[model samples]
Target chain A: MSDTKRFLYVNRKAPHGTVYALESLEVVLIGAAFEQDVSLAFLDDGVFQLVKKQVTTGIGVKNFAPTYRALGDYDVKKLYVERESLAERGLTEDDLMEVTHENDDEEDVSSIEIVDRARMAQIMAAQDVVLSF
Target chain B: MKFAVVVNEGPYTHQASDTAYQFTKAALEKGHEIYRVFFYHDGVNNATRLTVPPQDERNVQKNWSELAEKNALDMVVCIAAAQRRGILDEGEAKRHGKGEGSANIAPGFRISGLGQLIEAGIQADRLVVFGD
Candidate 1:
């Protein structure tokens, strides 16, 4: 398994309305088991998945928002959030929870990055495999 | 070229699975290798053997089973998603407290983890996803 292909998971759905958001996260967690270059791109309504204080008690579904915070522990650290999507939804970076990963020095580095539309396109175009959810 | 397919929607509910089946069939017809076919989310419904579609219409589940048999395709249904949707093989049905020998999984499709999809993407030259 020496192949180390670049994989980009493009998510463009809301968190609870449908299963795409959770489905995307599930793949990201499992994909972490492989020795491949993996990155997550959140755009459109998908930005709502990273919002802080996600409570699903009223909906009777297990609130899985906390799982996003633990993704870095599995080496799935690159999570890109589009700035245009955030603005379109009337939100700012402060509305989302902070996700961080530890470096060689054991210092925690922020994993959730807010990137512009053009940079997001570049990141996606450079991938060997792009799976849209 | 080596190809991998991901079906994110169910059989008749969405055209994703049918489209994926056609694409895989066409690829094979053109002499392309199919690495695997991973079913996720509601797409797990495509692996149910108990489904009885109308005689006049196309049988989605039956179509996949026949194609897999003909092509020797590796059709995998996400274990987590299948359990959530009540689509289980013999082992899963027994472990989940169902009656004796109660199994609903179709032939040629096995219950597996999401890691299979990652492996397909890593190994295949192209990973095609058909979904809403």
Candidate 2:
């Protein structure tokens, strides 16, 4: 077996409309299965993947947000959200499932750290592998 | 380390391509080698040679082509996606009986199958994706 790899998974698309979100999740699971240290970052519309109270049966699609909670079981506990993305969508930590936040804004969801884009870029640069979906 | 980059979105459609490009550049700068870049789904549009965006807008096609040329990147476009989206290489155009002069395959890019992606993944240390 190969040694474990460190991976940063960045999701930048909406959850329901596009396959990117689902596919990214699949990749994350695969990476975890390979014993890789995996982290997930949701930027732009990708934050919708963590949105609580989603109802997808109307669209004939099973809501996959619940699957996100299982990521911890796979040892993928590093879930991050961009503060700006939440603000852009008029969302807050209350709107999403419990996780960690990377920023410091009360009005905004404190669930995840709100790291600035520059810091985010730096984090991405430090990663051994990055997959954007 | 070697890498297989799968780009599934077009250049101007979103930041997926730009992000992929920047990451690839960073990877190279970090003493890493890109085994291949496989463009699929909407990403096959990145290989269209006939794109001519406005001067004010960023020409993503040119950027990709330039990077590919400088690094001698192995760029592969999914043939099925290319044909379905009206992007055809010389051989494909000829086989399909299109105009004789249609050159949809951009330089530094080859239309190929998923096998190329699988091969790249097996050879590289990592398989990264910039998906739509």
Candidate 3:
């Protein structure tokens, strides 16, 4: 077992409309500030946060997608994208930003992980701290 | 172990608060120490002092207060969420020109920022969240 503390932040909501996703991200960043081993998992509508070409300025909402990239600078390098979610939404790895790590060997993306939903569940079960958004 | 729990959903309307309550209980039973309980987003409503649920139903707000007091838990309400939701402290209520009664948040809580959550993680062994 890893001696480091593992934190799982599961964001299940979309960006922009509600504060759930953003606040969750903030919590993860804070966790990193404390030197904890933090990981983020985007599930359901939460995957929208990783989508590319978001235009919130037109709606007068602050574009939160840019903040997603800041996670890397904060040392939150583990970002997981659920595979079934992508398949159901007809989205490919190319639709998201470069910061995401795709786990799917089939997808040609270089940075995101596309794990199966069951595998995602396993990851959650393994974490010492799991926060759901 | 030292711990911090962030609650992002309102207590009355959702299951998030209930789940957090249960988790805290379990963690405490296992002899873990809780550092703080931060409420944000719609969760600011969890600190309302005027909540009055039906007599037949559980009074979640009062229950939360009791839990904190009994555990000697440190509770914080996010300043941003509290302002947007009209939940305020004495200083903020005066700044907003609202009456003292309108501004005082529920007792047993403090107003704080995201940085505090980070500090909680640094100071505690774990940081857990039950979000909306």
Please, what are the lDDT tens digits per residue for candidate 2 over residues B22-112? Answer: 8888998898999999887679898888899999987777887888999998989977667868888888999999989886777878998
TM-score of chain B of 1: 0.98
lDDT of 3 by residue, B11-114 (tens): 77799888888888788779889889888889889888888788999876777788888888888898877887888888898888886567657777878876
Q: What is candidate 2's local distance difference test score?
A: 0.77
Decide which is better by lDDT, 2 or 3: 3
What is the C-alpha lDDT profile of model 1 across A47-133, one tens digit per residue? 999999999999988788999999888998899999999999999999999999998899999999999999999998899999999
lDDT of each: 0.92, 0.77, 0.78
Give the best candidate by lDDT: 1
- Those runs of model 2 whose alpha carbons end farther than 4 Å from true positions after fitting are A99-112, B1-3, B10-132
RMSD over all Cα atoms, model 2:
8.9
Residue by residue across B1-132, what tens digits does model 1's lDDT show? Answer: 999999999989888988999999999999999999999999999999988988999999999999999999999999989999999898988887998767999999999999899988988989999999
Those runs of model 1 whose alpha carbons end farther than 4 Å from true positions after fitting are none
Candidate RMSDs in Å, in order, are 1.4, 8.9, 4.8
List where candidate 3 sits over 4 angstroms from the true fold: A1-4, A100-111, B1-4, B22-34, B54-57, B94-101, B118-132
DockQ of 3: 0.45
What share of the reference contacts survives in each candidate? 0.95, 0.19, 0.62
Reference-based lDDT, residue B72, model 3: 86
Which pairs of residues have clashing backbones in candidate 1? Answer: none
Ranking by DockQ: 1, 3, 2
